[model samples]
Target: MANVIVAGASRGIGLELARQHVEAGDRVFALVRDPDNAGELPGLASSSGGKLTVHAADVTSDSSVADAAKSVDADGIDYVYIVAGIVGKMEPMLEPGDWDTFDEAIEIMLKGPLRVLRAFLPKLSEGSKVIAFSSQLAASTWPYGGFYPYVAAKNGLNRMFRSVAIDLKDRGIVVGTIHPGYVQTDMGGPDADITPQESASEIRKLAEWWPLDKTGDFYKWNGEPHAW
Candidate 1:
């Protein structure tokens, strides 16, 4: 079985991803901000036949990310899925509004994934694949406006990991970003287009065979290429 790391596995898409990985008989390292209060992840782990582990990790912090990776104690990781994220406010905010939303968005969306990847670098084998979820709004081609902070952060995420893919190419690491479709999750809200299970399943399938040639590319939940 392949070794997998699912950061942000407390709930939503991350939790679903962890569950699916365990069901697939792959080794899973489920990282969350609070292990004691990690919702259903512990229950899922208990049923994983010892293939799933739960670790405390605050992706916004470097020390926490490092500690979580160190706790893995694995020879190498085959797949790294960075799924932790927060939704910035949907509507426009004026200058009077607090900048915390924007700050939080950039920190968790832009930097969190990179920090996790950096800390877990030593644990990743030659053919390891790194994947992260990006919003379609991040693309310049997206027409609908609003949600500036989230869009900016995700835009940065796409570009940052693309650069990472280039730098890690010689080492045989593949990095990719995907728009998970409007997944039905707490963040995506109840009216989203697809269930978390649907999104996660398709993502796993695509990621499993995603080639080194398309290392820096973006894709949709159905495996279609996403325009930059």
Candidate 2:
């Protein structure tokens, strides 16, 4: 089984992904901002027959990511799933908006994943996989202007992962981006069409059967190539 590290595993799709990985017998290192407040994670891990370990770290903080990386340095991880993100209050780009909110979204969605990748690069084995989460918004322009900043952040993330894929190619570290569909998670909301389980299953399949030639490609949960 693969030694996998999943960031933002406290709730939503992140939590479900951790559960699925542990169920599959892979050793999961679940990174969350608060372990004690992780309602479903501890139970999920405990029930996994000791296949999960929880670590506390804020992806938006450099020191926190660094410390978490140090703690997991000896694990020899095979996959790092960067799934931390936020949906700031929806607002148009031109309106009197909270610039701070936009900045926070960018920090969490773009910089956070890059920081995680840099921190965990050393612990990754030669054939390790780095899967960064992007969004469908990154490809298609939203008709509503409210989520402009969020979409921009995801677009930036896609580019960053693509660059990392090229840089790490010689090291045999495959880096790719995944755009989970509108799953019914906290972020995706209840009216969404797909479930977290469905999204995770599709993502797991893509991770396992990732084409070497498409290392930097963007993919949807259903394994179709995303335009971007």
Candidate 3:
């Protein structure tokens, strides 16, 4: 069984990913902002027969990430899933009042994974995978104008990880970004395309078949290649 890290595993896709991985017999280190506040993660851990462990981590904070990193075993984590992210409300670029929302999006969606990488990269070994929970909105294939900050941040994240993949290739680590569909979570809203579980399920299948040759590529949840 693989040792996996699921950042933002308290809820939604992150939570589902942790659950599914645990059910699949993997040892999971699930990171949430507050383990006490995590609705079902503690319960999952308690019943997981030692397969799952919850750790408190705020991806936007360096100190918090560093502290969380200490809890993970250095015995080689097989997968690091960076699933913590946020989306801001649609706002026109001409509007000058959405700075806070935009800032929050950038902090969580862009810098959050970078923080995770800085702390957890050493935990990964050769042939390990680093999967970022990115979005199709970042893709140039389908240009979207609104959501000034969210789109920009996701695009920035995609580019950053694209370069990181190259830097880590010599180590035989495979890195890629994935758009987890328009998941039916708080961020995706009620009328979104698919449930969090559905997206997580497809992602699991993709991860199982993920080729090292496809490192640095972007993909949809269903294993479809997505344009950068």
1-228: candidate 3 lDDT, tens digit per residue: 999999999889999999999999999999888888998889999999999999889988999998999998658888889999877877567755647888888889889998988898878778899899988889887665787788889999999998999998988888999999998898889999999889999999888788788898999999999987
Q: Model 2: which residue pairs collide? A: none
Number of the top-ranking candidate, with TM-score as the measure: 1
| True lDDT of residue 141, candidate 3 | 76
In TM-score terms, candidate 1 sits at: 0.97
Using Cα atoms with residue i matched to residue i, what is each candidate's TM-score against the true structure?
A: 0.97, 0.94, 0.95
In the order shown, the candidates' Cα RMSDs to the true structure are 1.0, 1.5, 1.4
Candidate rank order under lDDT: 1, 3, 2
After superposition, candidate 3 runs with Cα above 4 Å error? none
lDDT of 1 by residue, 130-151 (tens): 9998989989899987798899
In angstroms, the error of model 3 at 51 is: 0.8
Tens digits of lDDT, candidate 2, 1-228 = 888899999887888889889888898999998899998999888888878888988988999999988877356888888998988766676867468878988999999999999999888767788898998888864444568778889989999889888988888888999888998988889999999889988888888888557888899988998887
Clashing pairs in 3: none
